[model samples]
Target: MKVSEALSSRRSVRGFLDKPVDLDTLRRVLAFAARAPSGGNVQPWNIVVITGEPKQVLVNAVALKIATGEREFPEYTVYPEALPDPYRTRRFGVGELLYANLGIPRADKAGRLAWFTANFRFFNAPVGLFVHTPTYMGLPQWADLGIYLQSVMLMLREEGLDSCPQECWVTWPETVRRFVPIPDGHLLYTGMSIGYADPDEAANRTNAERAPVDETTTFLGF
Candidate 1:
C-alpha cells in the first residue's frame, strides 16, 4: 500500500478478530520499521512480542491485580499533571468519541472502567508488543520510539493488519515486568495490539477527527 493510503487507513483499532497474524510477516514488518530514524543513530527502542499462552497469562495476572485493587507506580507519566488548552480538549474528545461508539454514556463510569480493562487483554488481538527503553533515555529518545512505532503501524496496514498503540499498558509496569523479559535498566514504555480488526464491532467503527494542517502547522518559508 502507498504511504498515504496507510496513513489514512491506520487507526487505533479496539476490536480484533480471532485470526492469528503470521509470525514471518510480523518479523519482516518489525525489521523494516527499525529503519525509522533515530537521533545520532541511537536506535533506543526495544520490543518484547508476545502471543498465545504468554499473552493470556499476562492478561490474567493484570486482571487479578485489578481485582485486588493493586497498583504499580508507572515508569513514566503518560501525560502532564495538568494538560493545557487544545491538547487537553483533543484528548478528551477522542475518548468521548470512543465511549460514545461503544454505547457508553458519560455518566456510566463503571462501564467505561470495565471497557478500559480490555487494554490488558490487547482488545483480544492475537499479538501483543511491549515497547521499552533504557531508563536514562530522555525526551528525544522517547520521540524516536514514537516514530518507530508509527512505522510499525503503517506497515501493519500495508499487510492488511491493524493495531492499537496503547500507552495505558505503562500503568502496569510491574505486572508486565513479571511476565515479559525486558532488558535490565529499561522501562516498559508502551504496548501494542496487532491483528485483523473486527469490522462489525462498534468500537472499531469510531474514527477520531484530527486538527487541520492550518491549525497545527506553520508555513514559515513557503
Candidate 2:
C-alpha cells in the first residue's frame, strides 16, 4: 500500500477479530518499522511480543487486581494531572465520541469502567506487545519511541492488520513484569494490541476527528 494510504487507513483499533496475527508478518513489519529515525541512530526501543497462553495469563492477573480494588502508581504519568485546555478538551471529546458510539451514556460510569477493563484484554486482539526503554533514557529518546510506534502502526495498516498503542499497561508495571521478562532498570513505555479489526464491533466505529492543519501548524517562510 502507498504511504499516504497507510497513514489514512491506520486507526487505534479497539476491537479485533478472533484471528491470529502471523509471527512472520509481524517480524517483517517490525523490521521495516525499526528504520524509523532516532537521534544519532541510537534506537532506544525494546519490545516483547506476547500471545496465546502467556498473554491470557497477564490479562487474568490484571483482571483479578482490578476486581479486588487493587491499584499501582504508574511508573510515568500518562497525562498531566490538570491538563490545559484544547488538549484536554480534545482528549475528552474523543472519549465522548467512543462511548456514544458504543451506546453508553455519560451517566453510565460503571459501564464505562467495565468497558475500559477491555484494555487489559487487548480488546480481544490476538497479539500483544510491550515496549520499553532504559529508565535513564531522556525526553528525546522517549520522543523517538513515539515516532517508532507510529511507524509500526502505519506498517500494520499496510499489511492489512490493525493495532492499538495502549499506554494503559504502564499502570500495571509490576503485574506486567511478572509475566514479561523486561530487563531490570527498563521502563515499560507502553503496550500494543495487534490483529485484524473486528468489523462487527461497535467500538471500532469511533473515527476520531483531527484538528485542521492550520490549527496546529505554523509556516513563517511560506
The prediction achieving the highest TM-score against the true structure is: 2
Give the per-residue lDDT digits (tens) of candidate 1, residues 90-119: 999999999989999999999999999999
lDDT of 2 by residue, 1-222 (tens): 999999888888999999988999999999999999999999999999999999999999999999999999899999999999889999999999999999999999999999999999999999999999999999999999999999999999989999999999999999999999999999999999999999999999998989999999999986
**lDDT, each prediction:** 0.95, 0.95
For each candidate in turn, give its C-alpha RMSD to the true structure in angstroms. 0.8, 0.6
> If candidate 1 were superposed on the true structure by all CA atoms, what would the RMSD be?
0.8
Listed per model in order, the count of residue pairs whose N, CA or C atoms clash below 3 Å is 0, 0
**What is the Cα-based TM-score of model 2?**
0.99
* TM-score on alpha carbons, each prediction: 0.98, 0.99
Off by over 4 Å in 2: none
